[model samples]
Target: MGKLTATSAKALTAPGRYSDGDGLELLIGRTGAKSWVVRVQKDGKRRDIGAGSFKKVSLAEARVKAVKIRSQIEAGIDPVAERRKARGIPSFREAAALVHAEQKKGWKNGKHTDQWINTLTAYAFPAFGDVSVAGIDAAAVRDVLAAIWLTKPETARRLRQRIRTVIDWSVGKGYREASLAWPVIDKALPKQRAKVKPHPSLPYSELLGFLFKLREKETMGRLALEALILTACRSAEVRGALWPEIDLEAKLWRIPAGRMKGGVDHTIPLCDASVAHFERMKAHKRENNDLVFPGTSKGKSLSDMTLTKLIRDMHAADLKAGGPGFMDPVQNKIATAHGFRSTFADWINEQTSFPREIREAALAHVNQNKVEAAYSRTAYLDKRRPMMEAWAAYCGGSTGGNVVQLVNKSA
Candidate 1:
């Protein structure tokens, strides 16, 4: 096969089809249009791979493209199918944006969307920004996370998780056929080892002293703290508690599942002390506002940080007064406000012989085995009544003798 000059090929560009001198062919139609195509056979089957329009791809470039196609044919690969596959995979940036748009519709608020984008921009985008979605592999992902795994392990972990989610989405959408297997799946990335920190919890011994001081303070901070401890709830749950959710007469506080971290409604059985506290709060309730602990001058729920600061202040005051400060046996440090739940858990475990499931149910911890939990949904509120009463008495410095009455509202 000899080479075809542009002059010779132009001479054949009249109306129908003709071949270039090297067995690569060209087709010219009545509209003065010219197209270059390569004819190749594999497995006794003929196929045509379009090089490009004559005006765009020059003879030399078309020849090079044809040679590449011919090599692929010799390797038993279909060039047309390979081109289609390449076009299918989007760039990392484009695929991520598409995934973001699809996920944004289900997000409850704009904050969720903002968080998703912020995490990706801060961590994932920096490493895989320009890489094609199809080309990313486990090593590429490891390089992204390994850079920040030492100083920012938590951020790095979140970045890996988000990258996995994006790549998984791309695979589902056909932008990629396989996931970018994460190398940091079970082990920490290189140059970084997982740190062993103490679990956050308060000790049962220091809880009463803390509550005693909190009761004496008589501030909103103090009230919020007491409410949180009495209810055995997180700061967010106590801060966001509303008057409508409370039943003073029935002595119950129904925390909605949406407000609960575990997404299950928890019925807190109020003891006499908690009921008395609610009675005192009755005079403070606003006519239009619903929050049980509204912020000063804002008429909305108090900030979650308020109780934490109050706990810190109480610790400082105890230190100044030469009194015993809040201590956490588990962490061997000053207790955090959130650690009170652990204190309550310890009390239930040690001070009372309540059944394990009842204690776990009170703390809203689900059973790992679904079938077991489904069979045990009765919650044993009657059995839990005495336990909570004992806890309340311990917190209030009263003798633990009250036989808690079980007013079955369902009856």
Candidate 2:
């Protein structure tokens, strides 16, 4: 039987803990504030659970609530644990932090880890950070990603991936029953059209003239940019080149797996022009760093912006002279140092009889087909050597204007 009647619970004014019966109590404060609580014992330990305020929960209602809690205790379940589980559903922001903490160790570098969370913090947190992870649905995720889907497709794509990762982590931790966000959220986003502005690339016909002007400038920036074009390697790969990576006798530049984009070792056969250019750069090598293209400051690789700024300055100069300086015809933009890789690819496809696989291997592009990747162990260095040599001759004014159309009759 309960201790307090509805009439008595409201009439009491003193500040004290008073019991109703069957563990139900009326808690009164010194200021005469009133609330209901229930006391229960399980495993020789007593605990008090809040029922509600006396003003809102009547004695009859308190008894009903107490009865349910007692029933839970009798069934060997901790009511406190159940209550916490009910109240402690994680927010999206909290889950993201947990996911980051757990997964940061596996990431390649600190910058990548920061990028993973920074995107979520900037875009998704404001919209649904405080919302319960379990409560987050397709519409909520769509709302966050759709806003930037069109304007920042790259950012949106990364954000969507990180969000899905966080939600999947939540499900794995038993925080949510299912990850209802991904695949479905992908469909909700506006169909992103393929990007129109490819990296600006100079046409093969213009590359020789561009190389002449490029060679006129004598700086590490000029040499690095030239190496990038000649090898068709990524900026990082070219900028971070080490003295040990280059074997002048072998006429090869072997980039290790860690620095390469594909996470596989790549070998670039140095053309005569490219080899000579590297020899020139070797004279300017700093004592503190082995980078083939060291930054203006000692012991640092050339900044990515270094090459970009050089290209822009060249474009400005050409524009002043009323000449189109290494312009990408398709986009009407100044050709970038990175764009030279595409120029190389175009030269291969349009001018040479090299198989696409050989050309792609020269560019260090990974074969997407798993079986092909597994069986295609050879790098075909012997075949790529002649093509690179011809490319160098073309760049050095030894050839021009569809000079040698080595058409593959088999192809």
lDDT of 1: 0.71
lDDT of 2 at 27: 87
Name model 1 segments beyond 4 Å from true.
1-199, 397-411
TM-scores for candidates 1 onward, in order: 0.48, 0.50
lDDT of each: 0.71, 0.78
Give the C-alpha lDDT of model 2. 0.78
Per-residue accuracy of model 1 over 1-411 as CA lDDT, tens digit each: 536777787666477767665447786856678878888887897756677778888888888888998998899876655764668767677777888898677544455467777877877777776666765667667777777877887576557756877888888877664564343332445645536343355666567667667655456666667777776778888888888889888878888999988888888888887787777766567778888777776676777666667677777889899986776532336776677887887667655667778788777776889899778777566777777888888787322233333222101
Best by TM-score: 2
Count backbone clashes in candidate 2: 2
RMSD of 2: 21.5
Q: Pick the candidate with the highest lDDT.
A: 2
